[model samples]
Structures are given as structure tokens and as C-alpha cells.
Target: MSRSTCVPTSEPALVVAVDGPSGSGKSSVSRAVARRFGLRYLDTGAMYRALTWWCLEQGVDLTDPAAVVDAMDAMPLEMGTDPAAPSVRVGSVDVGQAIRQTRVSEQVSAVATNLQVRARMRDLQRRLIHEASEGIVAEGRDITTVVAPDADVRVLLTATELTRLQRRALELHGHAEESAVAATRDQVVRRDRDDSTVSQFVTAADGVRTIDSSSMTFEQVVDALTELVGSRTGRVPRAGSA
Candidate 1:
């Protein structure tokens, strides 16, 4: 796509794009940054996961790009941000719980790989960014590269493979069988490979800041990101307000 194809926004609204593999702490850090700045918090991965859940509910063929494309046009997705309680809706039904299932997690990558699916999803993401007033903290694999290439601050958060796997295991706790954690880890790695390979998505460049979360606490990550935002914008973000 040409650079001119990207939508331009009026005024510098401090768009922050956070990209990382699953369990790398992108979601937690993005939420913290949004809370600190009072910016709109958008979890783009949840959008894809919601679509995955919807497709499964509708019995769409996961491998068929055409069917996935058709379903994409028909699904209605709504996201709510409470910071304290975030949720996602598909149609009029709340599917926040469904989106996090192992089934959806296993299928989301296959569904997300369809070019038509990505295009449709990207359009929705652009609308979310456009509609935001103060600013937005958008987190996803392609946010810094495709969705918001010109974001004021782009962060690529990463952690050691073992650390990520441990974190995922903790999150799953009683939700997933203990024996399935390794399989889930493999799935996440495979999905990351597929997304980066097929989509040609790059998270960070020479100037983009990369944060290693392997040795950092959640609070430390937030503090570093807040400082980065301040350094870039020339103003410290007002904790709990933008």
C-alpha cells in the first residue's frame, strides 16, 4: 500500500501503538498507559478474537477465505472500555467470555490471515482511532506497522519465551488443562510466525522503542512507557486523565 493511502488525523493526538506476541504483556501495558493518560484503550486483538468466536458460533468454515470474508461483512462488533472492566460484544450479545476460550485462540490466527478479513478488521480499527477524542492506545500485531504507522509513540514489548509461557499458564490457571499449556505455547509461536510471514508485519523500526518485559514488572513497564510518552510529547501524562 502507498503511504498516501494512510488516513491522516488532525492535530497530534498522541496515538500509541503497542505490538507484541501473545502473553508478552501488550494488553496489560497498553491498558495501564491508557489509564494513566485517560486515552481511549483499544485492544485490537480482542476484535479479531471476537470475530473468531462469531465465526465459530455461526459455523463458518475456518479454512475458507470466501466464507470468512462474507462473515466479516455481516458480523457486528462493539467494544467497551471501563479500564476496570473491559468487554466485547458481537451483535447484541456479550461474547467477552467466549472470545478468550482456547477454541477461539486456536482459530483466531487462521481467521485473521485472510486478506479480506484483515482489510475489514483494519477498517474498523481505523474508525476506532478516528472516533477517539483525547487519543488512543491501540494494541495488536500490526498496529505499529499497518494500522497506525505514524503513531506518535510505537512500542514493541517482548519477553523471554519461557517467561511468556509461564505467564500464559498463570492466566489459564483453571480455565485450561495443565497438560495443554505446552500445546498452547506452540500454537502462539506458530501464530506469530504465520502473522509476521504472511502479513509482512514489522512492529518496530530504527527509531521505535522496544521494551523487554522479561525483567520488568508491570508497574515498571508502565513507568517507562509514561516517560517515553512524556519525552515525545513534551508533557507528562496526567495520571487518570489526558
Candidate 2:
């Protein structure tokens, strides 16, 4: 594994980067890890969803990279850390509910695929991490590879396609019909392809751990990650220090 960029400390905050495909349990695992250590948690995917909602509202062309970049720069983003009820804000407006709509979900990947948009978002992500005095557990597709490659602990979660699909379906429930689920599946597959083709998607690092969650309960995954963090730090994480 590549040398970790994480600086050691006597009472250091745990910086965890959790990466995985959609419905692979990144959110749940990341939240649990943060709660276990009392660290703040970030759902990076919400950033993209917020951006997508803004672009649609402004009628920006998703296919136009330059336009999307302009919108990204102009939009204001506010992220919250309350695990029980996290939120995202754009400008003076709160679009938390709007960003999760079926329309936004369908279009977010297109906007996310824009290289310039990703660059801008990456900058924002880095800023959030740097500003965190107490450490953070950030979960997203690119965190382990691009956003926080040098994080003290990098974990990649994976599960079978059927398991992922079922989990996603349950999340959608009445909001998405069969066609929407199919479209989401297609979008996920394409995103996977794009991420794999992107040179920076996965960093070759010695300490990066990959876990298959097909048969593991959420608690089991959390316990495993807790051990990884404990081994690296040589001590149990301090309360609220994840």
C-alpha cells in the first residue's frame, strides 16, 4: 500500500474514506464508523445530488461541461453533520428534498461525469476535510481514490448485484417504479464503467482494505472497520474523535 498521508497524533481524529458502488452500504457503514468514534460524517454523494438539483432548476444544459462548471462555481453549498437528520443547502435555499427526487437521481450521474464539475466538487471536498478539526468519515465513489487517498484508513465495500439492487429498490419504495429501477441499474453500471476507466479512481496503496459485504450484517462490517482503525492508531479512538 502507498504510505498514508494521515499525520499521527497522540489523540488524533480518525480519518476514514469509504468508497463503493451504489447500495454497497457506504452510507450506513460510514455513519456507524463516525458514531463509533464520535467523528463527523460526510455523505459526498449528497453534494452531487445538490448540484444536480441546482442545475435543473437553473435550466443549465447537463451535456454542456462549461455551463455545468459555471453553475458549480456560482452555487453555494451548505452541508450539515447531524447523523439522524443530515441536510444540504444551496445558496439561501434549502433543496434537501428536491435533490433526492427521481428526476435529480436520474440526472445526477450525467452532471457528475463532467470532468470539470468533478474537479470543482473535489476542491470543495478537500476544503471540508481540511476544515474538520475533529476528523471525519467521508463516504463517496471517489473518496478513497481521489478525495482522500492518503486517509489513515481506506475501505472499499462491495456486494452482489442482486443484493445491491434489492437494497436500492427498498430505498426507493413508492418513489420509483420498475422502469426507474431499471434505469438506475443502467446508470450504476455505466458509472462503474466510467469510474474504472478514470485513471485516478483507485490508488494502489498498501493499507487499503476491500471488504465484500454480501453476507455480512451492518454490525459485522462496523466491527471489522473498527478493528482496522484500532490497529492503525494502536489505541481505541477517543470518544467523538472519528
Candidate 3:
């Protein structure tokens, strides 16, 4: 894998780009990794969800491409940088919880697939990465390939479909039973299909390391990335730093 890759810039804001499928535990693991190393955290997926929530709030039709792009052009999204308490707000309403609702998950793809919308969000994500003085861990579907390909350390976390489905089921339903997995499959499988049309996240791009989290526990996943960062950057956070 390409874990030893490093950004050549002298800037102190280390941008760690992490891209992965939805059920691959990108958000939670990214947050933990950022906290461990004392870096800002950005959930790029939440930005898309926030836009979807805004479209829904304003009764914008997702099928209308022009309308969706216009809806996101001026959307006021405030993403919290704290790893311990990551938050997403639109205007003054905290839609952090609302964005994760099943409703948003189902319709978010419509907004995410619009080329114009993605371009705008991509610019915002790049600006966020640039503005983080203490560095930032940015995780989403396209961070490695599109958002910040020049990131200091780029990682592509992946897992088998069954493993991803089960993990997502457990996260959504608190159990990974047959019924729960069935219910959660579309969230992973379908959204991935929809997202792939616009971004190449199913496989690792050149120079991006891939970590298979199928058999790994959550702690193990975090440790692997932490060690990878250490291998590349020459420093790893001590245990219990988070």
C-alpha cells in the first residue's frame, strides 16, 4: 500500500484525506483518528446531507437538476470542526440528526449526483481543508480522488459487501441480523451505485492506500490508520491521546 506517502509542503495544516464506501465506517473512524492526532475533522458526507435536507425543507424537487444546483449554490452550511462533537448546521437549524435520518439517506443521492452540486461542494471542502490551521481529517466518498488528492496522507478504507452491509446494519439497527441487514443493504449498495456515477471511490486511486476493514474491529481500524500515518509522517499519537 502507499501509506508512506507524504505531502511535500512546509505548511503545518496536515490534510488527511480518507475516502470510503458508506458502510466502511469512514465518519466515526475519521473522527477518532483526527481526535487522536489533535486535528480538525470534517464529515464531507454531512455537507451533502445538509444540502439534501435544505432542498427538502424548501420543497425543491430532486429530479430537477437546475433547481438542485441552485438550491446548493447559496446554501448556508456550517460544519463543526471538533472531532469529539462534530455537528452540521444549515442557517441556524442543527440538522446533524436530521441529515442521518432514513429520509435523507434515501434522497441524498439525487443531490450528490448532480455535477454542478458536487463542484460547489468540492470547492467548499477544499476551502475547509485550507482553513484548518491545526490540520484536518476529511472523510467522504471522493476525498482521496477528487476533494484533496494532494492531501498529506490519503487512505481508502474498504470492506466486502456483506461485511459493509452487516456493519451498517449494526450501526443503524444496533444488530446485524438477517432482517436488519436486509433493511440496511440499500443504504450501502444503492447509494454506492448512485455515487459511483459521479465519483470513483469503489477502488483505490493511484498512490492512495487501501485498508480492508472486513475482519477488523473498530479499534483495530483506527490503530491501522494511526500506524499508517506514523509510517508516513514520522509521528503517531500516543495511546489515550484522544
Candidate 4:
């Protein structure tokens, strides 16, 4: 993992919102940015995935929007904000890892696309952001536009389809070979298509910065975002420190 040598500056009230499609590196980059800036972190997609996991565990009909919304209302979710060890828990079960399984990934879009569910989640997300008094780096599909449109720093991190596909493949599988990319297409491409119906993450919203990471290394992307934050908040990192 690449890391910046610049020491982190304390910015307790700086909220950074990052939005992107699947495999765009929003989660990793946002978490790293949060760590770099001493901010809390929230992965909004994991919230939807946890809901999907709960519905599946409870045998609720994901096809029924009302049931999904009801599930959302009764969900006892605990989201950890620490970027170093973020967790997702539903009730007493620790599902931080289970939510990332293929099962949840396949059904998450169905739960996420529900208009009622999104409305409820928007409220819950706002509350969570408010509670993170020290600041937060919230990343999700609609975060930059819907969830936190007025965050201190809003970013839309994107990359070419091929780049996204390859990255996701490497993360899911162990490599980015053609076979792995082929196996990972549905998870990366189809999910983005379904989720895009409710959020505008493909393009940068007004006053939102867009970081194209197609040719940039992970550290480079993080460095760019760090620099952007510095430019916006006047906490610039030392030149050539990384």
C-alpha cells in the first residue's frame, strides 16, 4: 500500500463526500483520504448491502418494495466510522465480511433501487453524518449529489470501464486476467447500470471535483485528492513529500 509521508493535520469538521460507480475506487480512496485527514469514514453502499443481507437472512421478499422499506425501518444497524476498521453490523450479528459475498452483491441493487428505501436511507445517512462530529468521508453512488450535496468537499471519482472492470476483477479474484474480468462483469457492470437509475455518479455535479484514475496509481489518486482537500481547506501537504 502506498502512503503519503506528510503528517496528517487535524480537521475535525471537514466533511468530504465522494461518489462513484462500482469499481471506481471510491471506497478505498475515500477511506485512505479519511485516514490521511484524520476524519471519520462511511461506506453508504455497505449500508444497502447490510440491508440486503438482513432481508435475505430474515427471508423477506426483496421483490416487494414495501417489505424492503419496512425492513429498513426496523433495521438495527451499527456502522463504525473509523476508516482503519469500518464495520457493518445488523442487530447482534457481525456481517462486515458477509455483506461482501456474491449473494449480497447480486441482490443489493434490488433493495437499493427502491425509492422508499432510498428516502429512508437518506434520512439515516444524514443522521449518521451529523453524529460524526469530528467530520466524515462519506462515499456512495449518490453521496455527492443526494446524500451530502453540501459537504465541504465533494468528489466524483471515475475511470474507464475497462479500468474499473480490471480493478474489480483483481479485488474479487486474485488477478485481472481475461477470465477473471469475464467472471466479474455482472458484478461491476450490471450493478452500476441498475444503481445509476437512482443516482448520477457518472459525471461530476456542479462544484464537485472529478478525479479520473484510469492511469493513476492508488497512491497517485490519493495524493491528488489530498492535494485537492488542501487546496480547498488550506491544509496543503508538503511539496514532493510522498
Top-lDDT structure, candidate number: 3
lDDT of 1: 0.81
Off by over 4 Å in 4: 1-12, 236-242
Per-residue lDDT of candidate 2, residues 1-242 (tens digit): 78869867656565788888877888888888787777788998899989889999999999998998998888988998665566799978878788878888778887778888888888989888777767888988888878988898898887877667666766776434666567568556665666555423333345568887889988898888888888877657556543
lDDT of 4: 0.91
Candidate 3 per-residue lDDT, tens place, 11-130, comes to 477789999998898888999999998899999999999999999999999999999988887688899999999899999999989999999999999999999899989999999999
Distance (Å) between predicted and true CA of 220, model 2? 1.4
Residue 126 lDDT, candidate 2, scale 0-100: 85
Between candidates 1 and 4, the one scoring higher on TM-score is 4
- Each prediction's TM-score against the native? 0.88, 0.85, 0.93, 0.92
User: Model 1, 1-242: lDDT tens per residue?
Assistant: 65656688655667898888878899988988888877788898899888889899999998999998888789988887655467899889999888888898888888878888898888889888878877889988888878888888988888877777777877876434556567667666777877776453344565678888899988898889889988987756674452
Tens digit of per-residue lDDT, candidate 4, span 4-63 = 699887555778899998898999999888888777899999999999999999899999
Ranked by lDDT, the better of candidates 1 and 4 is: 4
After superposition on all CA atoms, how large is the RMSD of candidate 4? 7.7
N/CA/C clash count, model 2: 6
Give candidates' CA RMSD values in order.
6.7, 6.3, 6.3, 7.7
State candidate 4's TM-score. Answer: 0.92
Q: Kindly report which residue pairs in candidate 1 clash with one another.
A: none
The weakest ten consecutive residues by lDDT in model 4 span 233-242
Against the reference, the lDDT scores of all candidates come to 0.81, 0.78, 0.92, 0.91
